[model samples]
Target: MPVVESTTRRTGGSTPHRAPGRATRPRRRQTSGLPWLLSLPALLLLAGILGYPLVRMVELSFQNMRLRELISGRPAPWVGLDNYTKVLSDTDFWAVVWRTVAFTVVAVIFTVVVGLGIALLMRRVARGVRLFMIVAMMFVWAMPQLVAAQAFRWITDSDFGVVNYVIDKLPGVDYQNHSWFVNPWQGWSVITTLVVWAGIPFIAITLNAGLTQVPKELVEAATVDGASPWQTLRSITLPILKPLLIIVTTLSVIWDFGLFTQNWVLRDGHPEPQYQTLATYSYTQAFGQSRYSLGSAISVITVLLMLGVMAFYIRQMFKIGEVD
Candidate 1:
């Protein structure tokens, strides 16, 4: 019998054949540079708007930019690290730093805890009650910081203030014409209360939104498994909400660490040393004391501190992304 050659042709004489599905599988397209190109204009605009001032501030921090130089339209003489040295050496500055750190810690803690509680409450409340709470919170959030600070100031006024009036009405309390700011602790308490009250709306609303994303089936499973409410929250809810908590807490720390409007306005635009935070301290140094360079240094330091917080936030976000 004659052997006939096979009619089929081999594409690759030695290569193994690939399965149809594997052969047809599409590769993921590389991410395009169009997105970066499209965003260039906004990035440039922000650089001009925000970056210039920041650079100038740093420049000023290295100089002796007194009122005289500001008025003379002449460049301030460079002073190298003298401004930083002066600021770092001042005992009062250290006191202000400690005070600012303490206030931030207290304010952030209260804000996050209270905000979380309100968020949980919102989840459990009747629809109408929840709506009312949301509306009230919206109003508070919409109100300007200046207005809120003024309102709090009026509320805690030494004379003709409602807080004193209500306290004095108690059976044996003598809070009439009480001065809240006379004591630093009391003043800080008031400031903290204002900060927490103002902050809760944002945190509560955001967390409540996150709560909606929680799987109802998982929650039900936990309940069916005889998990107490606290246990469920501790085990399930908190772990899920960890990302949101970190975000809000970091933002609260940044805002409260730079406590300015509330402290300045409450103290009538002249916060005493006892009540001074980094922001107020910077302003007091620059405008209040005409130490522009020193104030710039303080501001630069404050920015550095905020950057540290932001870095931690970014790191936490990366961690969450990795976990997901």
Candidate 2:
């Protein structure tokens, strides 16, 4: 009998063989251009609508576009960096910048703190109470900014305002015909209060939604492990909520930094020098004083500042994502 060849190799065992004509399947691409292609039309439309105005504003910043040039419809002569130089050199402009920053900081802090508190309260409340709170907040949020501003204006009005009336009701307190806007501190207080009030609903609702994602199991575990409420919140809850906190804080910063309508309406369309913010300053320069170029330069600077803030928040978000 002929000796049979062994199929198994000596090192390991029998070697597995592929079928003669089978081809390996190729992997699908992890990315595709289809999404980008589909998005092109909307992107182009936005570019046309928003991009042109931004470009025009930038172009205007480099030119001497005064009332005369605007009226004549003639091309304004380019003045290079003179507008920027003038704006930067003005002490009043710097004052406005500092004021704006201060207001933003205070408003954002108040909004976030109070909003977070309300969100936590919502979590602990009965279903009916929570529903009522949500509906009330929705109404508040749905109210137009202008309407809200106007309402605040009326409430704080010097003559026969409810705020003064309520204060006057107290013994030894004379608030009759009291003007809230006479002093800068009082005026800014009113503005900040309005901002915080209007902003809280959105922040609370968003944070409440974020709070829903917190793991109940982890919370219970912490409780069983003898963690106090504060400790549990600080360690377990906060870490989970960090990402959302960052987002809401960033949004609040952006909104408060660009404060315009409230201050404008509160001041009766003519804010005193001390009351001027970056938004109002820019508006006053362009429309009020016809210094269009200077206003454009200020606006460009404002955009750059906001961009800086956005960049910082975006970096933070990416870092959190990596950790996750």
Candidate 3:
């Protein structure tokens, strides 16, 4: 009878309940919330900075916020989608958009191709030469767009430019007095060259980093199996580096699409209205002509286009991941 009473005391009425291996439901819930709680501050900061400005820009895009209204401290009149309608209906706006697209496509394609070539070459070079090449590329990459434009202007000058002098020396060419910026196409060619040259360093460096991760054994095995260099690259290296290539290409497209400083500085303030990019065109509308609302609309369109490209890029990346 004593043993039975002791057993009951130990088993039920007096013993404290404890879970040794697992946490209680409430404690698990608290742990789950901790990550979100920790992230709240950063999220709020981003919302205040990035989110607020984007919202303000969208609001301003639909308003008549010309320079005069701003100067007079008047509340902007909301005009619904008039700004977008005006921009969309304008032939010049469409022309600029097309020009921007063409320039971006050309620049990104050349940059990626040349960058890949350079990365491949770097792998074959001696250590010392590779270092020198990397340093030179970094120097080019570090140059500001404005500074590079100015430098190129000096190089491509009409009378005393080194480029003209070189052209004069070339067979069947006498361009010593050539004023490159006078012609829109010539100006564009110069801009493209400068853009490609400036962009190559970043692409090459990033691609080289990606290349390092590619196994030498795989390449060697492919070589031993009678695969040509081009075949191996097409079948192996390219597939491995696809993600990095996409990232770099997308970034290049975005950067080149919004090209401003190079084109503007190259045009030298005598900008041929016909040759203006979306960025230059928007600036012209807002500050040059005091059409703030119209300019905001253009800016918004540019942002939307970029977002679309990014969305497509992300979708492609996910598809590739799923396939892998």
Model 3 pairs in collision: none
> Model 2, 236-323: lDDT tens per residue?
8889998889889998999999999999999989999988999999999999999999999999999998998899788888887888
Clashing pairs in 2: none
- TM-scores for all candidates: the values are 0.90, 0.90, 0.85
lDDT of 2 at 78: 98
Question: What TM-score does structure 3 among the candidates reach?
Answer: 0.85
Model 3 has an lDDT value of 0.90
lDDT of each: 0.91, 0.94, 0.90
Q: List residue ranges in candidate 3 displaced over 4 A.
A: 1-45, 313-324
Sorting all predicted structures by TM-score, with the top scorer first, yields 1, 2, 3
Deviation of model 3 at 239, angstroms: 0.7
Model 1: per-residue Cα lDDT over 1-324, one tens digit each: 122222223332343468776656588889999999999999999999999999999999999998998999998999999999998899998999999999889889988998999999999999999999999999999999999999999999999889999999999899988999999999999999999999999999999998987888988999999999999999989998989899999989888887889989999987888999888889989998899999999999889878989899899888879887
Local error of candidate 1 at 48, Å?
A: 1.1
lDDT tens readout by residue for model 3, 1-324: 687779888787654468899666654433578889999999999999999988888888999997778999999999999999999999999999999999999999999999999999998899999999999999999998899999998899898899999889999997978999777788889999999999999999999889998899999999999999999999999999988899889889888999998878877864687669989998999889999888999999999989988887788778778877
Model 1 backbone overlap count: 0
lDDT of 3 at 125: 93
Model 1, C-alpha of 164: deviation from truth (Å): 0.2
Q: Model 1 misses residue 107 by how many Å?
A: 0.7
